[model samples]
Target: MSADLIYLVLGLALLLAVVLPIALSRCAVSAPIVLVGVGAVIGLLPFDKYGLDPVSQQAFTEHLAELTVIVALMGVGLALDRPLSLLRPRSWRGWSLTWRLLLIAMPLSIAGVALLGWWVMGLAPAAALLLGAALAPTDPVLASDVQVEGPSVTDDHDEIEESDQVRFALTSEAGLNDGLAFPFVYAAILLATAGPVAEWGLKWVGWYVIAKIAIGVIIGVVGGWLLGKIAFRSARESLAVARRGEPLLALGALLAVYGLAEVAQGYGFLAVFAAAMTLRSQERGHEYHETMHSMIERLEQILTLMVLLLLGIALTNGLLAALTWPGVLVGLALVFVVRPLAGWVALRVGHRSEPIGVAERWAIALFGVRGVGSVYYLAYAEGQAVFPELRELWSTMAFTIIVSVLVHGIFATPVMRRLERIRAAAA
Candidate 1:
């Protein structure tokens, strides 16, 4: 590829990223599917594409996935309209389904995948655990079609005006689970390097499971509270950024909160989300929320496009060469079996607590869309420890993501649309 052709390709990809969302808005197909296809086509041509090798260049892949995830997390947090207060009890009512999905469904999914990876795929315990932890969370980036569209400001702060349980649950689950999945990832790392569960289990439980979560939430809340004051309630006339109509504070706030939490040895993903939610809580009816959210959403779109393109390119250019029959089976099973079964089991609680019906529950169960977050987790884990089946892990994870993008991508729009119609009729 010539320099000008490279520039041309870059410009065109950027254009497609900006336009494809609107183009595919009414169709069953998604922008990700199209982006992947485009990249695959580009890969078919004779060009030097070794620079985009994910397996060889793990750091680049990890950083790419990490940036996309954090950006998407910020957008997800800002886009959610549901009000969640950890300190408030009644507020928990609205988040019952979310809680169930995170506490029950996510873990069950992880265990199921881990078992399959170990039993059927013949992976070691640590590799299986890493696979489980990586694929466990529903991604905030690619599942946008099924998530809350954006934040809706209302006068009532206590109100959780959630008409779509499917979107709300999936969105909130994606947001919190990205950070929540860290404990298990850490567990996998310990199993790999720190020895068996008997030795490191207690330390992992206390530090990775408990302390880090607390630290992340605290940093997020404190940082968000401070930023909220600075943005919305600053006593000084010149200091209130939200009052001054600067929406970039959303970007600044997410980065600051994430960076601070990580520095404090906390889950930065959780802190970014927590800060975003806290910042959103203030000035509930403010337009600044939209501005900040819009900025995050735009960046998220660009990053998602880039990642998908690279993934598509990799898919065509020997990314799957290490893939075997077992890898394929595990990947397919995760998409078709483990997630839906686990999600259904968890969503049984929804009947009594949530307003969703059978179809909605099934939709929620089946639409646990996996994307860039999985990539980030796998890449991050690879950096921390040496798994014997690292190549196989990459291939299997890539296969699962592609299948998910195709399967869930094609069906999400139609399924959610039908459910919306049903909800409207009931209303």
Candidate 2:
């Protein structure tokens, strides 16, 4: 209870937060799970005398998770080295994964959630839609663990030129889709408030879907282009900034674009990501790519640790109090069944790489690791809707996210190790 003891405790936690992640890096375990476990154990003790009131400020928990998610998005955007394109040769193979994730997997996932909401959970249609949208976007922070290492694997000029197909696509997709999933959440809110589907049908569809998506895209392209040009070439010493390797300029671009887009009512997530991609494309062969990526990645890792620890605190404090058995079953189904089936269908189109064959593809799909982003969306949606099922939905989403982090985190390193050996043998 003394100030000195409090400071000591804080210092110890901070140390664990840093060291545990590095120590667990190549193992099948993850920093998030460990932090959560520690927090839970600490909570179980009679620590109320320590004066840490975890329940009074749920808002703090939500905002911390939100900040962590957005910052991770910025880092994800900054790490992408490939130029944007619809064509396969010019894009990351993860691009196909992104496309399939959005076009097929996303919609199907939403529909599946909605159906379960209606039949099993007995949730209202609007509440069902909200749950769907909230759970849809895969969290970039957690995916970063399983994602391929940096944009350039080989230092060789010829080999380094080959775009990192998997990481780029997954990072970019997670960045943009977080915002794209918002319109659906908004639509659910509108439908909940307004009368029925037929009444506001075309009008609501146009405004939320067409108008919002358009505004987000336009703001992204224009804002990103302007910021990229400024960050990369506005000064008289334009080439000097580039030559000096100032990667913090990337952070400036992220804040500027995200802030401006939010002010204009466009999706800030889309804008931040678009700006990063545009900047990367400006000098695709620049040596500074790794410099910028390394800096952002470090910051992202720290933020991830803090967020996961807080999430663990919340779980210990009673985040799952309202969870039901059916809800638990639904969450498991999403992880094991829906995601794998979707990944299989998406990759069924085929790939040029044999190492990432059908079996590998299935593994990737099955491990659709959810984490902070899902937590943010669910919390944000709860503020928007208070349906009878809202509490249950929150519990289920939290349960699913925790399960995914533990299961996938435990297996990612081992599985990736195996896959790499397999690829090497085949080669």
Candidate 3:
């Protein structure tokens, strides 16, 4: 708990973060799997007094997870190799996978989990809805293994260069859904506070679902375009940060667009991601995009390390004390049933529209790893409205994240390797 001890622990964790990625690259184990196990082991030491409790440290938890999620959003947005332009109808073809996952799978998963929460777990309606919304999105931070790598500049700016198709689908879905989940979370809050759908359903639909999403997307697209102009296409030479090699401009743009969107009452998560994608789209073949992505990726990794360690420590130190059989069942159901089934259904529906074979379909469905984004949503909601089953919700969400990390981490390598062979055979 001392400053020195905290520093010492972080110093060691930082070392592991740097080493583990390369060390575990060829193995089934992931860096997160190792870091979390280490944190759980560390929790067994006399540091019980030092572990941060999520209940007492709710504000810190919300903000820390908030920062981590946004940083990850920026990283993923920049990492995407596929070009997307809302203004161009042609651009939407390459992104059909992302759209299907976001639209069909996400809602179905949310509904399935909400039903499970209400009927099976006997959670209150509002609490059940909150549970569903919070866990719906696939996390970008902890899902790096299943996502596209950073940008690689090519000679053809107009060329439609793709990351691995499965990785691209997963990455783009993770990038966009964090923002998309906000409407459901707000509906849950309204249900809890406003008493009934008769009183607040219209308001939720108009503002939360329609207006906010439009505002976020419009502002993000316009703001990102202006920022891109300043960086890469400005009239004045000094205004072009891209030419000057200022990678930190990614951070500046991230904060600027996020603040702008939130102040305008739009979804900041959506704004951040939209802006990053817009920026990346500006100079498709520029080395500047890679520089910015690398910077964000490094920062994202450190923040993730801090969080995973705290979560693991919390796990052994009473975080799960409130966990019950219902909560356990809900957690298991989410990883094993809700996500996979929902995703498979969505992919199947889109099979005629796009030729995603069985293996790629399964990979995309099963690899929606849940992590810090869910934590952020839960913490943010707790700050906004009171939930009677807050303790149990925390336990279930934590348990689900740990399960996701364990299962996905153990299988990602072999699965991805097999997919690569499949791609080779098809080619």
Best by TM-score: 3
TM-score of each: 0.96, 0.87, 0.97
Q: What is the C-alpha lDDT profile of model 2 across 1-427, one tens digit per residue?
A: 3465345445546688568767986677777778778766655665554433223344655676777776777677656644574234655543656676677776777777777767777788998888777777778888866664555533453444323334444555677778788777777877777768888779766876777666666776776567556655666675446667887876666677777777877777777766666666655556666677777777677777666655565566676888888888878888887777866676565454323565467665666777887777766665665567766877888788888888887877777677667767877
Better of 1 and 2 by lDDT: 1
TM-score of 2: 0.87
The alpha-carbon root-mean-square deviation between model 1 and the true structure, to one decimal in Å, is 1.8
In the predicted model 2, the residue pairs found to clash are none
lDDT (C-alpha) at residue 304 in model 2: 74
For each candidate in the order shown, give its overall lDDT on alpha carbons. 0.88, 0.68, 0.89
Q: List the residue pairs that clash in candidate 1.
A: none
Give lDDT tens digits, candidate 1, residues 271-304. 9999888888788877788889988998898888
Q: Which ten residues in a row have the lowest lDDT in candidate 1?
A: 1-10
Per-residue C-alpha lDDT of model 3 across residues 281-332, encoded as one tens digit per residue: 8878989998999899988988898889888778888888888898889989
